[model samples]
Target: MNQQAEEILKFYERQGKPAGQEEILGALQELQQVLGCIPKEVQEETAKRLGVKPSFLSAFIKKYPGFKEVSAVHEIHVCTGPSCGSKDALKILRALEQESAQKERKEGISVKIVKGRCTRRCAKGPNIKVNGELCHHMTPEQAADLIRRL
Candidate 1:
């Protein structure tokens, strides 16, 4: 097996052969961290090693913003729920889009920005997730700055 897959299996085993999806999610996060993305082969190897059903893993990947099938330099998710909308989440989204576009033109950085569903953290509205890491209480300028830094 490849080193990344080996590391993911080792991490899963270190977590004590956990059967719960939450525990498995932790291992997947580690995989994302080490590999920078969770492609199909890695996902299948993970499922096989960890006794997780492929369908469950597939569903989990789709349901969570943190997991992605395709690789990219960064994936930014802007929360567009009612609470975040009230907090100008759309503005943050636009800022990211514009900044990412500018960077792609100038620096050739690849970024994918998507509108996300309610994260249910309404109190911490206007949240954006960058490469699976959540950032809270964002503004247009801050979001744009984040993209520039990336």
Candidate 2:
């Protein structure tokens, strides 16, 4: 087992009980909290340790917000809420989508682009999240520059 698998198993073992739905969920949540995303191999190892089917965890993770099965090299989320919309957030989203496509084709780097709702930072309209880190006051040119830099 790799270090990540061992660390995750250790967390489960510390619970000192047969892994139930709650315990497994807690473990997965902890993994996401610490690693930002739960890797496929880690998820499989976790399922094995919990004595449950891999699909169960896979489906469960998908249903929950803020949990990802795999971490992309770059994940961009452009807020499309009313506040952001008024600030041209969609334009930035489009720019990032185009730039990501071009970058992937030229350099083979994987990027995931998502349209996100308000992050409750209306004062900072036109917000974008790059790899889960927030950037406020974003413009299409800035978004394109970010993709190129990444």
What residue pairs are clashing in model 2? Answer: none
Instruction: Tell me the TM-score of each prediction against the true structure.
Output: 0.52, 0.52
Best by lDDT: 2
Model 1 stretches with alpha carbons more than 4 Å out: 1-72
lDDT per residue (tens digit) for residues 26-64 in model 1:
878887776666766677777777777878887888889
Alpha carbon deviation, residue 140, candidate 2 (Å): 0.3
Clashing pairs in 1: none
Cα shift from native, residue 102, model 2 (Å): 0.6
